[model samples]
Target: MSSIDIQHPHTLAPAKARKAVEEVAKKLAERFDVEYGWVGDTLNFSRSGVDGKIALQPNQLHVSAQLGFLLGALKGPIESEIRRVLEERFK
Candidate 1:
């Protein structure tokens, strides 16, 4: 499986960071059927052929996803979108 791991450092409060991650999760779920929730401070998400987590820290938001064979082919666009969304929301 190909992996998409992105770490974005931020100075936002934990609550705000969580909210941002939640918004991304919601949008992802709409199109990808992603299932997600908080496991302690980490937002874990998964679906067939994909799995990842958004680890919320005081000054950093780490996002990671693993794509299976079929989906791996689209890794570039997928990663790009994730980057775009993170930049948009976490700004």
Candidate 2:
């Protein structure tokens, strides 16, 4: 499997962060056929062909995603799309 991880600081409160995470997860789940959930303050997601986790800290958010496909198959585009969604929703 290939993995993509990203972490960055944010200024939002935990509640807002959690809400944003849920919103993003829902969108991803619907559009990408992924399953997502919340574990404590973290968001966990997995799909038939992918597995991943997204966590939110007081000042930062971390994302770790793995794709079961070949590295050249879906890695770059998937990661780019996820990053774009995150950037749009979190900012």
Candidate 3:
């Protein structure tokens, strides 16, 4: 298994950040068939070959995920896409 951990800083208010995260999650669910939900300020998500959580902090978002064997091989591209998404949405 491969793991990904990223801390992204943002300036949006908590409520707005949460909404942005929800939008991201919805898109992930639609595109990747993932299932996700919120637990306080954290959003937990999973699918057949992955599991992860995004924890929202006052000034940062912590994203962590574990990829299964097949997906692990594609980690670099996946991580890059995630970073791109964060930059696009949180900026």
The positional error of residue 25 in candidate 2, measured at the CA in angstroms, is 0.9
Residue pairs clashing in model 1 are none
Residue 75's C-alpha lDDT in candidate 1? 98
Best by lDDT: 3
Per-residue lDDT of candidate 3, residues 4-90 (tens digit): 999999999999999999999999999999999999999999999999999999989999999999999999999999999999999
Q: How much lDDT does candidate 1 score?
A: 0.88
Order candidates by lDDT, high to low. Answer: 3, 1, 2
Clashing pairs in 3: none
> Model 3 reaches what TM-score against the true structure?
0.98
* lDDT value for model 2: 0.81
Over 41-89, each residue of candidate 2 has an lDDT whose tens digit, in order, gives: 8889987777788899878889997777664387888778877877777
Arranged by TM-score with the best first, the candidates are 3, 1, 2
TM-score winner between candidates 2 and 3: 3
Worst 10 residues of 3 by lDDT: 82-91
Instruction: State the displacement of the C-alpha of residue 74, model 2, in Å, after optimal TM-score superposition.
Output: 1.6
Q: Give the Å error, residue 45, model 3.
A: 0.2
In candidate 1, stretches whose alpha carbon ends up further than 4 angstroms from where it belongs are none
